[model samples]
Target: MRLNPLGDFIDDDTFALLQQHRLFDAKSVRDFQIRKTYREMRKKMTASDALDKLQELHPYLQYDTIRKIVYMSKAS
Candidate 1:
């Protein structure tokens, strides 16, 4: 059940220091990617279809998370 075990994608020294001090949540990167994927899939398919596709791509993601991403506000 490990996520982002390699640390945040940003390798810069300042970002690394922030991560070391627990000033940020690296998991947000995964959230952002999942949200981005859902948005892209929504463009070519229905909400349910998009959810299914995202599940197929990232089976490790919880079902509720996928559902939330698919149904979240686009303006956010």
Candidate 2:
């Protein structure tokens, strides 16, 4: 019932509703998590360090790719 397993960005009921309507975008959710993680990491380190750690966690993503994702505007 929980579409957002990474965090509670939406309530379970809302998530379930979105799932039922097939309105959930897993990629968007993932990107949101990535941004959230980067923000949290930034609190403890420099921007470059945060991006470095993010890249380490997601080795499949290039440093520039992670940088783009982390710095991307929410309106996108």
Model 2 agreement with the true structure over 3-44: per-residue lDDT tens digits: 456445667777778878989787777777889889898889
Q: In order, what is each prediction's RMSD in angstroms?
A: 5.2, 3.0
Worst 10 residues of 1 by lDDT: 1-10
Question: Positional deviation of 60 in candidate 1, in angstroms?
Answer: 1.2
- Clash counts for all predictions: 0, 0
Best by lDDT: 2
Question: Model 1: runs farther than 4 Å from truth?
Answer: 1-23, 72-76
List the pairs of residues colliding in candidate 2.
none
Assess candidate 2 and give its TM-score to the true structure: 0.74
The whole-model lDDT of each prediction reads 0.72, 0.81
Give the residue spans of candidate 2 off by over 4 A.
1-7
Model 1: how far is 15 from its true place, Å?
A: 6.6
